[model samples]
Target: MIKRYTELADAVEHLLLEKNSEFICYLQPVTSREAALQWLAQYRQQYSDANHVCWAYIIGNTRQPQTQAFSDDGEPSGTAGKPMLHVLTERELGNCLAVVVRYFGGVKLGAGGLVRAYSNAVSQAAGNAELRMISPSVQLSISVSFAFEARLRQLLQQYQAALDDVAYRDNVSMQVSVPQDAEPALREQLINETAGAAVIRQVASHSGV
Candidate 1:
């Protein structure tokens, strides 16, 4: 299952040297092939003078990936793209892209050196990135007698849940979102506390986000 992911909110830099040449790795989060390619194009435009704008990207879940692509630009065939892709996969990051821009510094690092430099760039970016996880959730709606409003509010607080679309006419009707696993217990508490007077309906199933 795809549970957690690490992504960058903005581009991050990893700088290194190999025989005086400069390799800068820029890591950005992207959700689709189009976005990944757009990142590559934007980098190319921003670094128009760069010697090679090699890139690698995975477009979905790391474990069950949906799409992937890479390009070496003008660098050695397997040096830049393959190495960058390797770093991202090993880090178990999904829905992100990696672009490595090389500036010619009057130095020529051979195939092995290029691989090391490119991989190191991506590794450095990964090391400096911020990681976030998906939280499980459920959506529900509740209707209850006006007299039970304050009481229901207190019960929801127990689960750190809150009513979102509360309305008052004859009684109270509102929407709430809570932790997925807490739904059963929350329901039980409402029914028991109200002596079966509370009406609860689930609007959405458990989801990870």
Candidate 2:
């Protein structure tokens, strides 16, 4: 479970020159693979004349990502994208996408040079950008008897949980969002307070409040 992690606060772009070759690095926060690809497409189209567009993305926690990928584009097999991604992981950036567009400057940099160039490009961009922490939350559906409604409400407030929805039926059903770190304690309290009658089912997990 991700209690908290750092992420880019906003989009940033940086330019570097190596042996006259231009490397334009773009950094943006992205929550999903689709969004990463969409942002990459925009950069590709924007820099259509560039020689190569290399990209990498980490869609969840950097320490333990849900998914991540990289593309070298037309660059050497292990030159561009992997090095850029290494820089991002080193900096512990989560939910971020990096795209580097290279414009051939009439000079050929060897594989080693390409790797350093790409890595340095992303590193410099990240150094210049702002980062903020995110405490992810889980969405849950809880069912409890009417007898425990008041107690549950108090617990929710105690844990600073968000009340999303409430439905009164055979039992009182509630939709809630709670901080990942607080969920275990909340669950224990719910069960103990309701004398093991309360039930909780996780619906989804997401970053932010």
Best by TM-score: 2
Q: Which residue pairs collide, candidate 2? A: none
Model 1 root-mean-square deviation: 4.1
lDDT string, candidate 2, 1-209, tens digits: 67688888899999999999999999999989999999999999999999999999997778888899999999999999999889889998788999999999999999999999999999999999888888888889999999888888999999989999999999999999998899999999888877788899999988882
Q: Top lDDT: which candidate number?
A: 2
Error of model 2, residue 15, in angstroms: 1.1
Off by over 4 Å in 2: 143-150, 167-173
- Where is model 2 poorest over a 10-residue stretch in terms of lDDT? 1-10
CA displacement after TM-score superposition, residue 133 of candidate 2 (Å):
2.9
Q: lDDT per model, in order?
A: 0.81, 0.92
* Backbone clashes, each candidate: 0, 0
Q: Candidate 2 lDDT (Cα, whole model)? A: 0.92
What local lDDT does model 1 show for residue 95? 71
